[model samples]
Target chain A: MHFEYQVDGGNFSNAGVASSQFKKILKQLNVDPGLIKRIVVALYEAEVNIVAHAYRGIIKIDVNIDKVRIALIDEGPGIPDISKAMEAGFSTASPKVREMGFGAGMGLQNIRNNVDQLDIESVVGKGTKVEFEVNLG
Target chain B: MLVSELKEKLNLKVFGGNSGLNREITGGYTSDLLSDVMGFADQGKLWITLQTHRNVMAIASLKDLSAILLVKGQQPDADMLELAEEEGIAVLGSDENSFEVSGKVFNSLMQKS
Candidate 1:
């Protein structure tokens, strides 16, 4: 099955809606409980990243019989340094965003820690594409 | 111990998730950082925080938390309560701050266990 969700930047209130919905779908599919938790955590962090930084983004999920693939593509000020961004304590979030207990620079790392494979690509001023996959078998 | 028993012992106020009063309580996690709680909190813990936004409920639900306990008399936003009610994870409160509530909850759980 395939699913796509749209995310609007700065929409804090609706940030986790997509992740929650996808979690329901995973439950219906009877995905292993532990695997479901990890996947949802990665999906939610990625989803919040789009809302926190990008102007907007699209999340595409391709669920196969044995694995799940996810990609989040967004339009915004692209990452100038992927390596630096992956650092656990590095973040460019404004004071306002930090007040909400996010933007601590742990997002990408969290996504990486929970997923089987993580790949991120970006341009200086255009946008970014994040992709990853997890095995279900 | 069940969430309802904790509420009674601690004198917590239940503002929503009335149906989850019987949910099991595995432990307690106190933090204001969403990512920290998401990363470290285990299933069925009661989250103690001052954040009153809807995202708190989102994290609590995603983590399979038993309940959210608002500290320092923090009142949850309307949208936060709405989601808590829908998710059926108890959203309780106390007038004490994080430090005090954490102590009381810790002591209570220790006595029971």
Candidate 2:
């Protein structure tokens, strides 16, 4: 199964809706609970990053019998240093984003830690694409 | 231990979820950061955090957490409470700090075994 979600960056309240929907689909598909937990972690972190930092974005989840893949593409200020951004305590989020209990600089690292595979591509003047995969097997 | 016992021992307020709902909490994770909570929290465990944001509830639902306890007497926003009610996730509030609440919850689970 596949799902596409348009993340509205304007509303902080709606940020996790995409991940929530995908989690439900995974549960109904009888995905392993551990894999499902990892997917949820990665998905929500990626989604929160997009909403908190990006101007706007879309999150897509593709699931098969053997694995699940999530891609988050955002039209936000691209990270200048991918390596530093991957560090656990690096964040450029504004005060408002931090007020919502996110932007703690843990987003990228947390996503990397939870997923089986992680790929991040970004251009300073353009945007970012984060793709992660988890083997359901 | 079930959510009811946690509520009674902690003297927490049941801001959401059916009070009589029976669910066992095997462990606890407490953090204000959603990312850390996501990466560290175990499934079917209790989560204690200071955040009252909507995504907190969303994460709890995704994680299949046994319950959520808002520490330091914090109350989630109305929308957050509403969503928790809809998702059937137990929501509680306590006057204790996150550390205190987590320790108490941990001790409670340990005693039950």
**Model 2, TM vs. native:** 0.92
Cα lDDT tens digits for candidate 1, A14-131: 9999999999999999999989988999999999988999999999999999899999999989999999999998998889889999988888888898899999999978889999
Question: Chain A: TM-score in each candidate?
Answer: 0.98, 0.95
Error of 1 at B112 (Å): 1.7
- Candidate 2 per-residue lDDT, tens place, A1-137, comes to 77999987657788788888888888888888878788888888898888888889998888877779889999988989999999878889998888777888888887888888999999986899999999888
True-vs-predicted CA distance for residue A51, candidate 1, Å: 0.4
Q: Provide C-alpha RMSD values for all models, in order.
A: 1.0, 1.8
lDDT of each: 0.92, 0.84
Candidate 2 TM-score restricted to chain A: 0.95
Clashing pairs in 2: none
